[model samples]
Target: MNWDKRYKQNDKPWDKGAATPVLCELLNIAPQYFHPNTTALVLGCGLGHDVAILHAAGMVTTGLDISETALQMAREAYPDLGETWLMDDLFNMNSNETHYDLIWEHTCYCAIPPKKRQDYVNSVFSLLKPGAYFIGVFFTDTGQPPQVGPPFSTTRDQVFHNFAKKFQLVWEGKPSQCYPGRENREWVMIWRKP
Candidate 1:
């Protein structure tokens, strides 16, 4: 379960090496919503492609990950980002009542142990300003669970149900192209804090 070691070994199958297609589509379809200067946070930003893109577009972006190796790689790869790359467990993030306008949750939810799903939801909710938005992409599958997983699979209903208490589901759909291994299994979701 040493994620840093896995990244060091170049074993991250979840690292698509690019910004997610769904995120790109979101930016394209609603450019006004994803304003360049909006304060944004990205959870579990592995290689940081999304972080770099947001930074380049002028957002005050912060990328958080548990693995030092991944953070180092992200910093080195996008030195110009000048992003706040922090090595901290997402569940343990203490923003002290400060909230972000947008939170980009790409692969953090399903990657966590199932028992901690609610905590993840609560933590993210705690970090968002009232009426702020959260855009997430979750993986779904019908097969047996993997022996070891950072890319775990979850059902769409479960995700919606979990967030319903604290958020309103504004948009939910699937993008045309996901990374090779995730095609047909990703749900693009947009939720707004109440």
Candidate 2:
């Protein structure tokens, strides 16, 4: 998919204007996992809402996206966060720049083609500091045919199969709050790289 062109055309149906409530709830319920020195990488951080949330929580947060337009929009919207926006492909991040204490996944996982799902898991595993966390709100069911997606639907087994190799499950459950249509479709998970 031409993400830059999509951003250029303002065709982002997935660009919710704010951070996922799931992240907020996670912070509220598990504050011990986040701290001022924590370095967080938010994948596909379109418009920067979740990045802002993580920053506000006192982590050194970086919002990374493949679309320059999306990063530009993020920077414009959060001008004080000048250094927080990064333009890079998730799969091709600079080797020396890959370490992070936390990686926050929201729309990025489901937005990628299904065939790349395992690579996504491996890439995330390779980017974290030992025992660092991988926290995300995944779209388990998009209510569309399973085969048709950019926002692909997935199952708990698939999640386990992809992440079990390198991550230890910390916590996971459906969030109490969600964006309008996401109700039971969203799954919030926290994993630690051990």
The most accurate candidate by TM-score is: 2
lDDT of each: 0.83, 0.88
- Candidate 2, residues 1-194: lDDT per residue as tens digits? 89999999999998789888888887898887777878999999999999998999999999989999999989899998768988888887647455999999998998899899888988898889998999888889898876788888888778987888889999888889888888999888889999
Tens digits of per-residue lDDT, candidate 1, 1-194, equal 68899999989977877987777777778676478778889999988988877776677898989999999999898887775797888788765555899999887787788778899999999889898999898877724484345566788998998999899999888877677667788888889999
Error of 1 at 62 (Å): 0.6
lDDT of 1 at 167: 97
| Candidate 1, poorest ten consecutive residues by summed lDDT | 142-151
Candidate 2, residue 168: how far the Cα is off, in Å: 0.8
Error of 2 at 52 (Å): 0.6
